[model samples]
Target: MRHIKEYDGLRGLMALWVLVGHWAATIYIQFPWPANLGNAYAVDVFVILSGFAIATLVERKRETYGIYITRRVLRIFPVYWFYLAISIALAWVSVDMWTNAAGGEATSNRLQISIAALDNFWPNVISHVVALHGAVPRNMVPNGEYAFLGQAWSISLEWQFYLIAPLVIALGVRAASSFKAGLVLVLGLFVLSYISPRFPYSFIGRYSAFFAIGIATYFLVNVGIPFLTQRRIVIAPIAMLIVTALILLQLPSVLPVSIWIVATASVLVPSQFGLSAIAGLLRWKPVQALGQMSYSVYLSHMAVLVLAMLVLEKAGITSTYLHAALLLIITLAGTLIISIASYNFIEVPFQRLGRNLATRPQAAE
Candidate 1:
């Protein structure tokens, strides 16, 4: 349960990949890298990280269910509410800009999510908290001018998943000693991961693999199941390779889903060194540092793309290559600077608050 440096490296890499994906979307399309590795494809890494971290923390609390739930809520909600407030503010500004352009006010067909409804922002906020936006259609209407509003979809999904995760882990912990029960849960999650994509607006679609992968990975790593732990190193690289191939090949239509699930499953391999072969490669310090800042990179990458666009627009540079390079520079630089601030100012404080509150003493014995 101690932090894995190699996983941190993967975090950094995945964040970078996601940044590139978004850059490709919001800025220039002339980049040399594959575009198929969009936010949906790469952000699962975040989900997996969440699953891993969450399970590690909560599994230890098998004796204290209330404490477990309280700890989780404390860990998750503070940072989330802060982020949601920021998102709402950003949304307000975006909506403001679009509605009152120089050409005068432009009205939106969907004003349910408007500032007028700001008093009742709880519904939209709760939907985001519950990851039900995609599940329930037209709940949060897109602001025509602000582009990153779509990306909030991931935040909503993460929040929703976090809510159920404790119960899921509670079940998993109960079923842990029973290999058959754990195995059944794994199978059910796997099935959901595969079939949810077809659910037509289900929040479970596509991203459910992340939860499955994380939960399955825990059992694979810790449960002493001979079949799973034996070939972990081999599994890691092979799965990593498969994920890479899928990304490079731009395999749409659930190919990414397939590779990700396989890759996630590979995380279960015992210590047979399946992925350990690449450990040397993934263990470099810089890579781990990158992973630590992955969240900052992700949150700020879109802003980087926007800045890159503005620069290019002002300079009248039309080529994709130039734009991509600028984006890379801006993203890396912005990621570093902003992540430092975000980690210190945003992420770390709430993390301490969560930990302190969870560990605090009760009022009167």
Candidate 2:
């Protein structure tokens, strides 16, 4: 638990990657940088990190199940509910205006906002709240000017992944004796995710392959990849952050393909049995910090964008580009502040609640 602080860096960094992906996409509407960097894979990276982190947190081999679930709830739900508070409240206030912005849909109806009609709201509240929309055909990401609201879809996916992955992990512990069991479980989940379109494993499929990668990575890292643990290796999420920035931001001219490619590469690159520079970067400091609050950053970023745009609109500026640029600045600043603050207040507190509330010590855990 004490060393978990080290993982915090990855969480913040991955979360930031997600934020950058979102911000990049928003800018792409005006700037056109490589064009493929905007998919939810950066969020996928975050999911991987979440799975990796939770694997460490709840492994029955490592800790008791009751303490594990309680700790997980404390870690995941409070800030989640708090952010939901932020989203619901912001959604409430902006509903009319946002509805007006949508123009094609009913503007003032709570039913519309709450219901989130497929054609109009994209999976509505039920799927959104439960993180099930990705299982079906609904576009989990937003379309065009509708970008801000779509960010929540990843949160939904993350939430659902959190719920189901533990069960899969626990199964591995019961079914097998070693990390090999975990690998089978993770690969099985990956196979499930790969075939999700046909079978519909959970509420969504965006996280299928990504979550599996995280699980596998956990085994590889924590259990040591055959001989790697003998050498005491690590991923360095902060380094990943820096490399991600350089490749995605500083040198896109030199760096072609897309963030989508990069994200997939993030997963695949690790599997290569050689020296890993990018993985080392992912384990970097600044990158790690962004990864830590990445969850809060993902969940709350859209609201920040929406709020920023609204503020810009009220400030008498209506140009889409200007609004977007201003929105980016404001949203980035606001999202970072909120993410850090929430991590400290809501996220940290709740994530730690189980520690304080636990009936036993290490034994309870």
Candidate 3:
């Protein structure tokens, strides 16, 4: 039940990776480092961590499904709704500018996301309100998942997982054997994957494997395999090296996924001698602070970037390098201020409120 401070730092780092990647891509800047441009991979890491963190919560805390869901709603929705309001406002004001931004191909994708955010405005609002935007396919509703807040597609995905996590945890607990449970879980995920083509690409089924890795890790580190503890320090670097090699080779899909599982599991290993070094870096103060407000940073950065780009374009910043430099500085400054304020005002208070509401006793009949 103890909070893992290192996870916060990891989340912070992932948020920055996504922010910087998007910023760079929008400006057509390619970093020399492969992972530096890996926005999608960073998102996968978020899903893995979400699974790990949520599993830890459900396994340790005894609560009715109603209370559990209530807490989750308050945790996610308050900050999300705040950002949704901002997205809506900006969509009305600057959708046209983004739609017509220069750097033609370089800015097209960002423009598409911004334009779609308001394309079928009402329907997008409704889908986002229910947090089922991720389950709605593009054919049925074009870009519905990313319609309101582009990055919020994953927020809806995480919400869907929160709804089912208790049942998943219960099933895992009842199975009583980690191996048997894992076998069944893998089979179920395979079935889900088989049928996934019939569903939305953004549906939880497509990403459930990452979550399974996290849940499996929870048991491995906490309950199932204590013997692996000392060896994890050695395993961590080996896993990283394999991930790097796989990246270099661009091997089969499953190989990378397998190595990612090892890498993620190693990062979650408890702090000890060699492992503590990794933990120490992850727990650095600035990174930890960034982690504290990471949700706000991730959700709000796009709006900041888009709006800043609009301003710069209108101001006739013609030089590509100059434009990118100015945009980066403005976006970072704006995102940091907004993230800090929102984390303190919106996330913390609503979380406290959710806890109070969830803990209140039901009246007797």
* Local accuracy by lDDT, each model: 0.57, 0.56, 0.77
Best-performing candidate as measured by TM-score: 3
Local error of candidate 1 at residue 214 (angstroms): 1.6
Q: Using TM-score, rank the candidates from best to worst.
A: 3, 1, 2
Q: What are the runs in model 1 whose C-alpha is more than 4 Å off?
A: 30-39, 63-135, 138-148, 173-202, 225-277, 315-320, 362-365
Clashes of 1: 15
Per lDDT, the best of the predicted structures is 3
lDDT of 1 at 174: 65
Could you give candidate 3's per-residue lDDT for residues 186-292 as a string of tens digits?
67778878876765556899888788777877876686445665555454555567667767888544442553454454356534225656577678899999999
Which of the predicted structures, 1 or 2, would earn the higher lDDT when compared with the native? 1
Please, what are the lDDT tens digits per residue for candidate 1 over residues 1-365?
44566667767777777776655544424335444345555666667766776677667644255665566565555544554455565656545533532221112321223553354455556555544555543434332112223455565566666667777776677675888778876886788667665443336545665676677666656663456446553455555576677678876624535534443443344254454444644577788777776666666655444444455556766566765577577766765786677777877776677666656654333
Which model, 1 or 3, shows the larger TM-score? Answer: 3
> Model 1 reaches what TM-score against the true structure?
0.67
Per-residue CA lDDT of model 2 for 1-365, tens digit only, reads 22433345545655666666655554315344433254344555556666666676566336555666567667766776676556656655565445545221122332243334333443344444444444554244322112224555555556666666677767755656767676776777677667656632234454555565556656654564446535655344433565566676665322322332333334434554332444566567777777667777877886786677567657876565665578678988999898899888888777667777564575655
lDDT-based ranking: 3, 1, 2
